[model samples]
Target: MKPTRCPWRGWLMLCLVWASGSASAALPIEHWTQPNGARVYLVRSDSLPMLDVQIDVDGGSRRDPPAQAGLAAATALLLTQGVQASPAGPALDENAVVEAWADLGAQFGASAGSDRLSIQLRTLTQPDVLDAAVALASRQLAAPAWADPVWARERARLTAAWREAQTRPDTWAGRRFADAVYRSHPYGQEARPETWAAIDTAALRDFYRRHARPCDARITLVGALDRASATRVVDRLLAGWANHGCTALPAVPEVAPLTRPERVQLPFAAAQAQVLVGQPGIARDDPDFLAILVGNHILGGGGFTSRLMQELREKRGLTYGVFSQFSPGRHAGAFSVSVQTRPDQADQAVELIHSELRRFVEQGPTEQELAEAQAALVNGFALRLDSNRKLLDNVAALAWHGLPLDYLDRWTAQVGAIDRDRIVRAWQRVLHPDRLVTVVVGATP
Candidate 1:
């Protein structure tokens, strides 16, 4: 007897397999401009019993007043710590906020990076739990506590941390590297000890109003709800957020080619010298971003397979590990190669780096290397969106950078299409050997 022909079920099975395979690319996103001036990005997923929401303000160290390098960061730190005393509801201080989230099995935190400040929350999808979490979170965001006591404590704590960071070689190296590469650009400004000392409650209030305005905020919600429900919950919570007239991100000045290499050394008693080198890199929205990203992987970003790693670690044994990065900002940010090595080997390492950098720029990656890199990046793309938090982060990044909504969908294709010649041309345009700044701390004189 012949088996029954069930083509309909076979088709359904095929679709299911395809959907599972295209999980990362087919991420359904509902993005829109909110009525209250915030840009919101939402993705509904009932896969798990929780929801993740992140709010990004287009204000970070980049928006700080030139004189107050730490103000923008300080402002973000204070937003989640405020509370209002209402006879109707519970006390909403920072401690109360923490306890309420804990009681609901939710997590809440804030982070300030170079270009933005983000507040993240993860809570159970249960109606009561989500509702309470949203209400508590909104109180702090819509109407901040701005308590004098909270300001004093947070300021003292931050100031102490800043002062203590000076003692750390890595921290100091980072600050120095930024200063060397960015120069007059706002991205280069270091948080002065005096700036932290000067920061007061008044400064914090003004900075928050100017930088963290409602219009500059982008909200991203992912996981555990339908679009309509997510919209209602988010809109209801943030509807009252009004944008006061205050400019956030200012025009970033153009970065000029360095007339000569800049080498600034800070004497520190350590076993290894920390070195940083490179010049101005591409902007966040640069058209050649994919080309550069793929090329970078073959040069130094690909751990053991990287040219720099193979030469510096495996062949010469100069140091344990050396890494490269491109920190793209509103304007061109730093493209840096950094390593730490014995004081005696610092000079040798720097020459090897320069040699590899020059050769990479001239020859680019081989076909085999490019193919391997493309495979590595393309294969690993799914991991970038494996979880709610990771997906939320990518969505927020797209919203913040004004990238195409389908950027992630096209990422693998873009990487795979980049040939050796295209990457080489991209490097030729970006990497300038003559102008690269070389900075080494604790190198032998």
Candidate 2:
């Protein structure tokens, strides 16, 4: 008897796999430009009665004007403090509004990063609450009061915080590492005591004017709402924003690799030393991004399975924990590994870290290691779309990175296709232990 070929069986298996994968795929992305010049990303889902909206403006710390180191950050913070014609009355009183939102089971906050300032809101998909939240956030973004007294108080608070950070070894090490790596670039400048003191209301307003133009912003909307209704809400909130044309961004300085290890010491009576090492890394849009990400996971990014953890913690017991990560921005960001250990073990820990980095560069992770990393990355991807808030974060990242609408759909396939050889090449190209700018505070060799 000869075995029979089952064509229908293969077809049925294919359909079943497709259906299972489709159920977890990201919602279709609809991109449109608002009349005011702000870009919007809308993803409609009826799975949950919640909505998440994020408005991103290209007005982060990098946009600060010369000699106004903290101006951009301060401007972003003040946007939520007070708006024109609001009950909070300039220097916007957030306590009352925050409490009110909490009562309504909603949340709102703002954050500023190296490349953008974002205002985010999450609320139940109820009409009245959503309408109010949208209106209030728009008003706050459009007409923030840069009052002198408010600016003065915030400056004092931020300055004190910076001063306090300077006294800590970990903070000092990170700051010095940034300074050494970026040199004269905007990334190098720290929010120092003098810089904070010089931040006045006029400076904040001027910085906002230069960077917070509608044309330079992008809005992302995700949640359980139809396109028509979401458009209406967005129009009501942001339609009034006027585009003042694009602002000229300063050219990013070319970063050079560090020549030797530099150390900064904080004279604190502590038993442990804080260390940060590595240098300027690839940009966000690099073609080898996925490969680098996977490689880093094997090197230091993955918790217990990574080379850094295995060598530093498991083998030598030099540090309780150690990890490395790549931070992507508009320009190239840092690749850093941070660790804390006893003062006497600092040099040994640093040596082990460098050794592992060099070994990974010379000979990458094994087939088993690469397969494990890929599996982890692929299997965990579904969690990214588990909620409206998480979905909105993914969309916001896509908008920020200028990725295509189909990025989410292709993500898993891309990760699956990455091979061990590609990861090895990416590791060698990006991770240079010898050229790293090392910062170790509170321990001496």
Candidate 3:
């Protein structure tokens, strides 16, 4: 699981490369449903001696009860740390579980996120090892130990970690940025000291039971297994699963827009001011997603060649680097621009950001800029799916988010179809330069 308050990494890049004639063979994503109502997606690849299987549910931090912010993450971590029981075998505990997989030369890892909780296993393609790994996964999902001692230790560890996070400048900036941009939305919620204190073992269990439903989850498998064999493995492993469902979390409310330009100042005396700008962005299913991707690259999602980088770093040397991202979740996601600069330059940074955003909305990307961005997006897009694990993540996201199966195949086509007019029009619809939220931590008075 992630160790920090903010787990999302900046996505998109400048100079994203596209090799004009390069062709990528589309891997078929096999889809099916288990009797227990779990949706499954599979892609068999014999290229590796190993197989990667991932189980994802919609039990992300967004499901954390307002009173107990870290409950979702704690439950995810405690799964591997406790006893897991299969239908007929003796229960396996933390160490035993680790040794069992090690004995088979396989790896088991899991983490919870803002959108989902995932347990991933990597094992050599031996039939016995694969079978055991799948069985172990099912057990972990169906029956985590839910023991008091394990909960106590994890709670203490998380409390200490979050308490310490408060002392760091980066953490300070992130917390303020999230609060300012997301306002009352769950996406802005972070685990505070009191949030930790309120979450006991019972809270964790209840949160897990209600939100971690297999019926509400998607299973993705990649590497070294055919449809028939994989089907048998999944069916047997998850046979004990039941379709009993629980109450669903409130539908994520519509993300509120910034009614006016507001700047939040956090008193951190670090050398540079951390400025984050912008507001809610397109969602995964938003038709504008591809266009936003292409346009954002030209704006700031692209690394150095992005307009923000060009303005903030290349032209003024106000910061070493500045980047932007369109972070999509179950609901509308956030679109933000961030940079760290000399504390004294905070005002200038914010002004420059607004100026560039104004120009971007009014003028849009140039033909040369769009062409370069498209090339980079198309080229980098192939590399993003080059590995089995990457393929599993990409496909699992699609399966979980209910995007069309052909979404991957259509990715490049969509990126190619994005033009200056569409890009400009998207920015105009999605962003309001005057209504953006600004967070300046460590700024000079």
Candidate 4:
């Protein structure tokens, strides 16, 4: 029997099926252990023909040996410079592997944060491309060549970069803010010229061996791939890599509340002062985190609707933008309000921010404000899953923080349940406006 299809009706049916399918599709999360005792999270999505592989080692700058402060950062950066398989012969340079990866439309980049060192690769999902990426990453991870010439060049480059950072107002403000908040903890130390100078090839090798191990690492896979195929890719590429079985470093010391105001002045002719103000806040697992987040949004975390933005930008035209964020590290992290305003208005801007913060602490946000904040947060929560990359980020963060598998499913509900009283109490518990550390770069007062 010949079936006649109506073109318009068929298209409508197809659209309905696709919409229903997408609606029913769960965020696919598959976890498995590798032979080397490493944990891997696989997120399978065929939305795009790309793959993102992220390897997170437990040691970052916080694990830097006492003397070699920047060792972790330097080692993470140099991981892909060259490997034993692609060592620099007489003619080839150590950067040969790095250049090769670039030429192949693959990028190998690493970042050092408070808790972990992350190495990420983004590449197409073709079998050959994926194979090359995996091989390249495996070689870089397992057997970094750390050629002397390349080390020397990179060290010089980093030293110069560090020197340059010292002169930048934003850099100065961030470094000062971190130092002020963490205060004598390894988390406080900024990479300096002396620290970069201390990093030698031997030191880098020791740092890498101690920290970058399969046992001490976790892998996150995202983008267009299936679980079965992604598992095979990770296993074949990373399974044979040996684990060094290194112990985790001692936890960062709890940051005591800032006793007094601390300030740093960076000399610059810029029109606006870069102001950073805050102290250490809650960890990721804190039950009151959502309430505090909502409170902060009303206070300064929300862009235009926040109190700080209203007081500084909307009402008084003091600054272009003012915002606050609470960055939750493995340990306690910073809760900061940042603003940039003309130097003459710096003191006024700081005072207005403080006034709003105090109001939040004392009076708390109104029920209407809280409701709006929660609604916005809950409504926007799904946007985090709009892309595979973002979903992978959430997966990585969840795995890193030991969050439950159903964390995302419950996130919006939890946020939506936060009430005005809860937000007020959370604000009072976590924020001490009076004890905040303020860094003003390019301002005298």
Candidate 5:
């Protein structure tokens, strides 16, 4: 007897296996604007019969009013909670909506990040399955119920979780850090229980209507579909998502830089102290992005070998681990170094961190350090695109940032070309050592 063939889920696994071997090579991105005004980016992969789609709009937390801090997040979440009845079908309660996707063996969900509200879908490319999945997703996107009871229940649950999280020291450190780093910017506006309570179904609907428009969508597709099939998929997915005549939203101002060093120390009953340091970093479109990325790897991003890790963890045994990263987004995002240590050692750890950062900003990385960071990044670049999902994410980011279509093709070259001078210049231009923000929670006051 012959072996049994795998089903849809198994086909996806097979696709990953097949794609992994070739993922290291550059994927050609096809671009076009749909008649409906949506921008679509495609990476066609015929390795298996599956499709992954991501749709992004400028409906993120940044669009939320400070008083309604989580309005965008709530809107995205409720999109799939229930969908209104339509000419094509009856209404779908949250449970029924979930079951419908299950029956089709497809997945669809929405989320809000700092700068984008995104809806994603994955389905087998069998003609009937793809069509049904697309149609269902279209309905959910176009006709969210914004039901009162559902929002109430979700809000209660979220509020409960938020309350619990507040009890933790790390949460306090993070929230306080964000406030100091962003000041009056929307990026600093974290949702509280009170903020969640302020958002109602009506607010959600209004936010969805204003921000989730076709003209603002950046859609990315990666799968076995050709350009024609992908176009059809997009059309069906956004069929009735008519444009609202590209009305410009009020311009969100850039994050304001700190005028001087700000320090916050909060007392708590815990054995470990949570320490966060650094300041506002670069935007995703910053010219020094690659240099900052590479330089950071040498300073703190790289594990074990990073200067921060070596100084704080290896040499002093201050903590188990310490890491730094730049959270680059649509606007300037935070660059932070975080570590946890004994409550008594909080001041020492912070001082050492500041000392290391100041030294790095002044002298930059050594020639050997730059070479190693570049080699590690270049050699490991293939892993970043070793699956369909990864490819979809990369393509989506490129589309969102208006980056060169060949960006991925030049990733390794760009990373390899970073010399000491470039890294030094980039770091010097971006980071300000004197104006760093330091926050310590659970420290001995």
Candidate 6:
């Protein structure tokens, strides 16, 4: 289903003219649970004749066994390669599966992220086409073949890609940074050649069976379907999926916070030094997520207007560009600042980052800064929902994270209401300037 090797023959791209207004004003979401226990979220967009669907399962890399770090990713990849035969249909190999979708003028794919494994489909809303595409997707979701030959080929390709990535200095720095920040947490686990080699067909199948269940599905549908049609589509797509009395999974430990400053220095023969700094940050469900988001935009996430870019790039000429980010997830993800500069200036760059972060944490953003950030974010919010595909992704996120149904409707207003004092309070509570981790690779002696 990954349209990579075998392309769709009759794929038609849909175009629409989205009206200019508050994004929340236009999106009205409907939610319900199927009898099989899958949670469904739908947004009816009648302006287009296409349908976009996304299914999110809790089988992301975070669920992988420590010994087989990339198991979830590999499993997601193989789902599209082939499917086993069942009473509903005959078996289909990778090429045959691709041809089936191509003939239907639809696209389907599966990929794993840090928190979830997502299966997505895009197809025309014609009755005949929609039914066929949903049936094919159901085959992929319910009956992945997990063929040994395909795993062997994928592993080799991934291993070679891994080897090539290792030759880059940024990769070395990133690995060290993750290990230092996450320590014993599963969030830090990166698949190695040996780990990829260790994963066989059996482990992939086991992971899928355990995690990819109807009970755990958060399905989102967006496009030209009303509630009735959307409900029927959901039922048909999940017809082959059966609940097996789902039980709770053993909980993975949360990402631990750093107790003290940690520094990693690795010398590599490269032109520029890669410097990374920071520690564990907020989780997705944190009440202060909006405040922290605004705080980060002022710190480094607002691009040219961000403090980090203004200081490190524009004023001091330390690097061509620099950035800070908060990668919040089910658990605490990293809050990192990254930069590349001359080997000789690595230390200076790190110190500037430390000072800027410390000052911002101690004294929150100015009122003027907060106003500008709010205006920029609020005005541009509508672009986030300009297409059905984009809306599907947002709806899927809301379902997966248990965010309020009105979250999108209130996004801009809530962001605008965040004051300077709240931003300061959030920064002080969330970030520890003294306990940051620093990783500098390819630095001069």
Q: Candidate 2: minimum summed lDDT over ten consecutive residues — where? A: 15-24
Alpha-carbon error at 141 in model 5, in Å?
0.7
RMSD of each: 8.6, 10.9, 6.8, 7.5, 2.9, 3.1
Candidate 4 residue 380 C-alpha distance from true site, Å: 2.4
Report lDDT (CA) for all predictions. 0.78, 0.75, 0.77, 0.75, 0.90, 0.88
Candidate 1, run of 10 with poorest lDDT: 14-23
Who is ahead in TM-score, 1 or 6? 6
Q: Report the lDDT tens digits of candidate 2 across residue range 123-167.
A: 666676677667666666667666677777888898888878777
Top candidate (lDDT): 5
What is the lDDT for 195 in model 3?
A: 85
Q: TM-score winner among the candidates?
A: 5
Collision pairs in model 1 = 45-224
Where is the poorest 10-residue window by lDDT in model 5?
Answer: 2-11
The runs of at least 3 residues in candidate 6 whose Cα sits more than 4 Å from the true structure, single-residue gaps closed, are 1-11, 16-25
lDDT by residue (1-445, candidate 6, tens digit) is 5545222223344233342221233668999998878999998877667788998988899987788999989998998999899976999999999888877878899999988998999888877778888888888888889999999999999999999999999999999999999987888999988999899999998888888888889989988899889888888777766666788877878887788999999899999999999999989999999999988888999999999999999999999999999999999999999999999999999999999999999999999999999998898887887667777878898899999999999999899999988888888999999999999999964
Return the lDDT, model 3, position 401: 84
**Model 4 scores what on Cα lDDT?**
0.75
Instruction: Count clashes in each candidate, considering only residues at least 3 apart in sequence or on different chains.
Output: 1, 2, 6, 0, 0, 0
Model 5, runs deviating above 4 Å: 1-25
Over the stretch 170-241, how does candidate 3's per-residue lDDT look in tens digits?
A: 788788778878888888888877887887777766767776666876888887789888777677655644
lDDT of 1: 0.78
- Candidate 3, residue 441: Cα displacement in angstroms equals 0.7
Clash pairs for candidate 4: none
lDDT of 5 by residue, 1-445 (tens): 7434335656655655676654434668999998778999999877778889999999889999999999989999998898899997899999999878877778899999999999999988998888889999999988998999999999999999998998899999999999999999998899988899899999999899898888989999988899988998998888757678878888899998888999999998989999999899999999999999999999999999999999999999999999999999989999999999999899999999999999999999999998999999998888888888888888999999999999999999999988888888888888999999999999877
Give the candidates in order of TM-score, highest first: 5, 6, 3, 1, 2, 4
Q: After superposition, how far is residue 80 of candidate 1 from its true place, in Å?
A: 1.7
